[model samples]
Target chain A: MTEKNCREEIIFAGFGGQGVILLGKLMATAAMKAGYEVTYIPSYGAEVRGGTANCSVIIDNEPIASPLVTEPDTLIVMNQASFDKFVPKIKPRGLLVMNTSLIETPPDRDDIEVMGVAADEIAHQLKSPRSANMIALGVYLKKRGLLTPQQVAESLPYVLAKRHHDMLDVNTRALMHGG
Target chain B: MSEKILITGNEALAEAAIRAGLEAYFGYPITPQNEITEYMARRMPEEGRVFVQSESELAAINMVFGGAATGKRVMTSSSSPGISLMQEGISYLSGAELPAVVVNIMRGGPGLGNIAPSQSDYFQATRGGGHGDYRTIVLAPSTVQEMADLMFPAFDLADLYRIVVMVLGDGVLGQMMEPVLLEKKQTHRKLPAKDWALTGCAGRSQNIVKSLDLVVPRLEKRNLMLQEKYRRIEENEVMCEGHLLEDAEIVLVAYGIASRVVRTVVSRARKEQIKAGWIRPVTLWPFPSRQIAAAAERARLFLTVELSYGQMFDDVRIAVAGKAPVHFTGRAGGAIPTVEAVLDEVKKLMQPGKVAVER
Candidate 1:
């Protein structure tokens, strides 16, 4: 794990409505709650819903400078297109976490760490495909060690809508299952 | 110390305004800035404050004008196109010498541009986007924390100068979430007694709050008065931050989101043994000319990084006054310049043979 004060920039990219933005927000909120300066910027455009949507999240001990991540330290890709688009942009020796259910072929990058989780499969096992993002995030938190699973779970109430509160247990289970 | 909360810039601004005792909020929904209006709509009514979703930006700015004329802390927010629609009312507010805060979460420009972030509205914001010989105090906040913190000072400065104060930001700043410490509710020390406000004359002489001074001489006098107030604000209200400039050979000038990118560039440049510094303008209308000039005295080069195609570059050139070379690198229509690009520009400027002073 990197020392405190070092910046970690991550990109959570997928097709829209895959909870990419929500996952980024959740990670940012958890990092902030753990006393790290954090920034989360969502990719916004006319084609936001069904198009390729990605968000950049940066967490550091010092104040963050830029919210846009050009070469992220970690890339969490939930779809094949997101994997193909963002895989090449990850820093050498960075972490690449992909949803294996959607991305069958692994990236050919030997310089970085790769973690493949069947996030959608796990979410389906949990009877909620929408919880796939949580599963991927669980793998990210477990691998990166930048944030604790406890911190991410504690932040669920803040990021999730109030009406979805009943699904906190399911999401938590999905997160733990993937981790 | 207050607990740090994760929030977007628009949400922070709305929360800050509520804490600042915002009396009324009148705004139309616009992308990138719609969150501000939404947050206000949800919170303002609960506070028993006035929040009106005007049918159009024109109506919203006019509502702001009416609210501010009554001596209440009022605000309106919108993106580029919507802000353009409100310019006339802004000019009226300025001409009437009414204090108001307007937040422009700038998006891509020209006409009906995309919802991505851009600083193309720099000229419109700093140069009195509306017609008239009046200036609005502009504060460009780069961080979500500043987005919250500056609202209090923005309202105070607007009230103090009796001018429209703009909190100019971009869509990136508006949409990005960050940790911010919400300042405790403030009690202003000396709020000006708005004696000029038209609160209806019970026994005193009737007060009129009108921007129309049709007579040429009176209009000329009013313009001069407004100029004097602007001059005073220019003298007292210029705010900027200098980072790692004590022994810098090059200084990067930027504001809002661009400045945030410059910080990273400066740090990276320093790692490569380049003496790069940055001057971030917190208040844009006052322009921070003196700080840039002071930096020019020592730094061999000045680079202006913006989200516009050289809009603020003109100001940088004017401020440098040819004492040192002034260079520009930017992207318009919502493209954010990357750290590598800015660092490359810095390295190019640092080359011994590449330095050329702008005439």
Candidate 2:
């Protein structure tokens, strides 16, 4: 058999307001800046508030043909619902980035790599739990060389906007400190 | 290359359009597709690009028609029902041979259907839902990156063929989060001078752009020319993806969300040593009939998974051409089938003589 290619499909899922989409964007932008073709797709239910939100990102050196990641190499579950809905789809030897403050039970698979981070707690320590998304993004960057701190920081203004400029800086710091 | 950012399919498309240097976006609001409009509404005005939330889809598509006629890069998007409303305008755009991009985030249908993702618009998109004989360049995006990446190609095709190009996506595909490399914006392609384009001729003769050819011979010739354009599109624009099909006994044919779900199911089935492969069509209009036909000769059973009841299945049957048994499994009205549901169907369709460890 030919050597299996090592491309990463990362999924970030959580409840509304957890900034699931923002984290996915940060990862995609960082990966793209790293010279990898990236695709980011966000999925949400009907409910605008408190609804389930999940985003999938695929980073590869070759030209990525499809952006929809059916099978993920890593899963970052921030809520119970997010974990329950997508846990089964995680591939073998995949990474699990879970929010210990939210998801209590770890996944059942023993072959996979599991990392539980108290994102909310860390964010609270930073006086901004919402930056938990940024914390999770930092971990992703550390584990997978998808992006650099500088590249991700460049896209901060476009993502965080003027209203959240201070928050953006804080989140960037959180990423740096956490990763 | 720019840094990576996680983005919604809608936001990805919006940013991609900005990157692609799209000049105008005319659209209205609809579920599972609101982000596409919202992204434009928030960015277009600030970018000095045109963005209009028209009262209705019809007005929005017609506005796109006007903008495209001026050789400006234009786009408009809506959901299934709203897309139905825009069909008349689409037919006109096709008839006038104008170039533009139309995105349809499919949902439960026939009328004002539910907001959940559905592929009911497959037939409407592939078989010319609009009146008269016309074919739009239909691109089915299964991932958020493809959703963003295809914009440049979709726009280029529209400009190249002088026809309406469409990005057909279901709610799940549109709403899903995935990483996408937004290519840097390119310089806008200048439209070649068309004698018929409605440019005020600036010291030359007058120009008129219209589809109404009252003369029968002239109308017939125009339609014949359109038929030629469609033939070229079908011949050259076929795009698809094939996975683990060599030496497989069964091939699962699907697209968009269904294809994504089937891909996972195939992986799980392989763990049990059940060999199942898949053929995913990226361009729905130029259906991957050639790929399906080639695979059918080696595969015994053709299983089709879709959100709607037996729509894309028909295409599978036609492509397989009785070389194998074609089976279909679907759930409508926004019901997302689990991997178990798909695996169960796949096992049921395994040939009678074939043996496997019962789950």
Candidate 3:
């Protein structure tokens, strides 16, 4: 009872087609299923196809206030551009999850814990390049221990469209493998 | 208990409208609000309701006017520029005493501006955007859950008063997703009959609905009747929420997404022993002025935070009536105010001998 309920603010950023928004949505759905108050807001603009896309997600035991995350507790970047843009904004000693295959250089910060996962390489090995985001998500969940693999697996149908249900098995494998 | 699902604010509004037994949805696609039209297009036809993506915003609003004239639950949604374009038809609906709901997922304004969240439309939405003397019931939803919950009451209020109602939100609220337990389709609530509907005059006398009157006295009488109805609305339906106001020294007045930011500020300020409170106006038109006045009696100062350049600050000043010093902090042209920026403003306001006067 002495421990206050923790609030986790996360930002997922990548190229538009990298499924960054969907990754945030999946995390938000899983968080909601786990009985936490959650909010997900995606970066929207006219150049959504090839442009950079990001989303902020807040999962708290208490009711969430603002959906905008100015400084995030976790930074998940799939590309170098996103890393450069958002790495400075992470809270000190925060968790930084990056796609090592894309960002060759690591951040210079000594305070934060940086977890570099070869997400794209793993997805390529699995023959499912689109599942890179799932791999990254799996890494974040494992590091944070906010949600279990089973919880995310169960919430897949809620976030994924019906036509893409066939990919759930690969997504789950990628998630568990990354974890 | 109903099942909870993650839904964006725009999608929540569309789903709630369908559950509220919406008969028709007519709207053109616009940024931040296009999701509503897309959702309605997908679901309305499946549910055997009429859904149309009109050629333009002007045509869409007229379609709402036509559908509402037949006493059907009709609605249309848009962003700031699109809503501005629909003002003429909105005026007609208000003058004709037709019941309709218009959802404005407001974006940066004046012109096409940008497709970003903004509350700059405060004056436009609350003070009557269209011509002539008229008032529309404005409901400002701060959460995705409220985005769904308010639609039922919005449609109900419109029908009860025989006037147009607006659900005012911004792009941030429209795009953000949260868990919500949507109420079941409203079948139990009693709805007043649309006896003035322009149905065929088969067994009864013809019912004519028109806003134009050639005579001056008749127009004046219509204006006076509308004013009386607005007064009744103000008396019965002023809704707001006061948070941490019991022992507060500073009260922050905000609505919609800005209110959400203010809530965070209040919490952070409390930890630092700053007795900051917040008042969120749920209904912007009726404007819960009494609540603000009461808070002024207890609080030493008042502040207003908005996504616009002090648009809602005027209303806050009016409510405080110079009883307490009122300050304003805001961002316009599609920028959102950060927590640090707002907290800095609050800290400055708490400084000694720096008072704010009404603008």
* DockQ metric for all predictions: 0.77, 0.24, 0.82
Between candidates 1 and 3, name the one with more favorable TM-score.
3
User: What DockQ does candidate 1 score?
Assistant: 0.77
Maximum-lDDT candidate: 3
Q: Candidate 3, after superposition: displacement of residue B51 in Å?
A: 0.7
**DockQ-based ranking:** 3, 1, 2
lDDT for B301 (candidate 2): 83
Across residues B1-359, which tens digit of lDDT does each residue of candidate 2 receive? 66455667878877887777689999999988899998999899999989999999889999998998887889999999999999999999988999889999998876887888898888888887899999887888777777888787788788878988889988877776655568864535664554556666789887667888999999999999999988888898899999999977879878887787888788878887888999999898888898999998899788888888878888888888988878888888877666778888887777477653312
Compare candidates 2 and 3 on lDDT and give the better one. 3
TM-scores, all models, native as reference: 0.96, 0.76, 0.97
Model 3 agreement with the true structure over A74-151: per-residue lDDT tens digits:
999999889999999999989999999899898989989999999999999999999999999889888888888778
Model 3 ranges off by over 4 Å: A1-3, B185-190, B353-359
Clashes of 2: 39
Error of 3 at A34 (Å): 0.9
Clashes within 3 Å, all models in order? 0, 39, 0
lDDT tens digits, residues A140-172, model 1? 888878877777998999999999999899988
lDDT of each: 0.90, 0.81, 0.91
Off by over 4 Å in 2: A1-45, A48-162, A165-179, B19-21, B42-48, B184-193, B351-359
Q: Write the per-residue lDDT of candidate 3 for residues B1-359, one digit (tens) a residue.
A: 58899999999999999998799999999999989999999999999999999999999999999999999999999999999999999999999999999999999977999999999999999998999999999999999999998998899998999989999999999999999898854634577899999888899998999999999999999999999999999998898999999999999889999999999999999998899999999999988989999999999998899999998788888888989988899998899998889998888888778665543
